[model samples]
Target: MKEITIDYALRATWQAVARMYNEEAKQFESTMAVGFTLLSIDPKTGTPSTALGPKMGMEATSLSRILKSIEEKGLIERKPNPADGRGVLIHLTDFGLEKRKDSKDVVMRFNEIVKQAVEAEKLQHFFEVTETINKLIADKKIYVKNTTNH
Candidate 1:
């Protein structure tokens, strides 16, 4: 049997969570990406089109595709941005709001179930470990190239 590494564990867990979300979203004729995009947009003020990519940690092309898909489904609309003359803001339509609520409910249920299943201390430790991992990556502590060539 192969030993499990930290990256493998993180990737596997995330894949499972994504698959679960996608399966739930399928009932609404949506995908996980679309639902996530809906949730990311501000419900009231709307979000700048350029900001969505950075906010969601998504690439522009991928975010653009998701935005287009949701727009076609009547889940969102694009409007001229008041703050930026050259930019547009993404707003959720009534249907989008409804779907966002559904997405929120699904996410909340998942968190609630996980909290109920795991001990609080263990959960806190899990959070700490993940945070540390993120910090290390963000700080460029991992994968530093060897200064001396072999």
Candidate 2:
């Protein structure tokens, strides 16, 4: 018997969850990405494009394209900045807000089930580890990239 490395465990976990999401819901990835970030952002201020790009693991141009597509689909709208005439604020439309509600519910239930399935101590460990990783990525821009020969 061999001990499983944390990286292996995380990869397995992500793959399992991603597969489940793919099978259960179409657009799960994109919807959750926008929905979760929008939920975190202030509707009044919205998030600055400069801050949002790196925080969301997206490049500025890529993020812009995504926003444009989403806006065209009627999920979001851009508002002119009052303070800075050249700036624009990203905001969720009614449809986007509704999707956020649904996404939040699904995520909450999924988290609850995971909590029940995992032992308390182990779950706490996972929480700490994930939080550490998230903070590292968010605050320090550190990402663990795996490069392997195919």
Candidate 3:
């Protein structure tokens, strides 16, 4: 049998999960992806696409296209900045707000189901593992190359 290293194990887990969610929970998946990526921005201070693209690990052109599609869907709004004519800011529409709330509820229910399946003692460890993985990939320091290139 082939050895299953940490990367392989993690990749298999993520692939299986991606397939499951892609098949059974596409709406929830997209909402979760968009929400986490977008909501990371401060509500009081809007962020430009250039700043957002790097943080979300998205290519600038791809993120722009996604933003345009979502905006056309009426889930988000984009506005030109008065401070800088070339600058644009992103914000959620009322529809987007309602969708986000619904998405949050769905995720909470899903979490409850997962918690039920896993042992209580292991639940905290699950969170710890999740945080560790996030720190490894999502930390700005780890992916500083993107920012420096921009």
Candidate 4:
């Protein structure tokens, strides 16, 4: 039998999930990226434009595109950051807040459905394992043997 790797499984599962969300998003003329971006931003105070990319694990160019689309849709407004003149804060408009709530509901529904289908212990372990994997990669321990700098 052929062996399946963790990376392949993660990528495949994520692709499926993204496709599912994209299908749902079509009804609202949005994409998975936009929905996720909406949820990631702070609805009340606003989020820093610089911070959103890292926070969402998104590349600057891709995030810039999404932000541009979101802004063009009248969902968000970029304002001068009072704390930093050079930085901008991305804030949700009233319409954006409404859409954000909808986005939140979609995410909550997905979680609730998964929770209902899976055992709590299994879910917890899944999270723990994913976290451990993330930590391993973030700390560069996974590639330690290959890197001379380590």
Measured by lDDT, the strongest candidate is 1
TM-score of 4: 0.94
Residue-wise lDDT of candidate 3 within 16-86, one digit each (tens)?
75565444446654644555544544344566766788877788887877777767778777778667789
lDDT value, candidate 3, whole model:
0.68
The number of clashing residue pairs in model 3 is 0
What's each prediction's TM-score? 0.93, 0.71, 0.64, 0.94
lDDT of each: 0.94, 0.70, 0.68, 0.92
lDDT of 2 at 141: 68
Candidates ranked by TM-score: 4, 1, 2, 3
Q: Across residues 1-150, which tens digit of lDDT does each residue of candidate 1 receive?
A: 488999999999999999999999999888899878988999999999999999999999999988988899999999999988999999999999999999999999999999999999999999999999989998889988789979
In model 1, pairs of residues that clash are none
CA deviation > 4 Å runs, candidate 2: 1-3, 27-41, 133-150
Q: lDDT, candidate 1, residue 20?
A: 97
Q: Give candidate 1's error at residue 49 in angstroms.
A: 1.2
The true-versus-predicted C-alpha distance at residue 6 of model 3, in Å, is: 1.8
Worst 10 residues of 1 by lDDT: 28-37
Candidate 3 clash pair list: none
Between prediction 3 and prediction 4, which has the larger TM-score?
A: 4
The sequence of per-residue lDDT tens digits that candidate 4 reaches over residues 40-103 is 9999899999999999999999999999999999999999999999999999999889888888
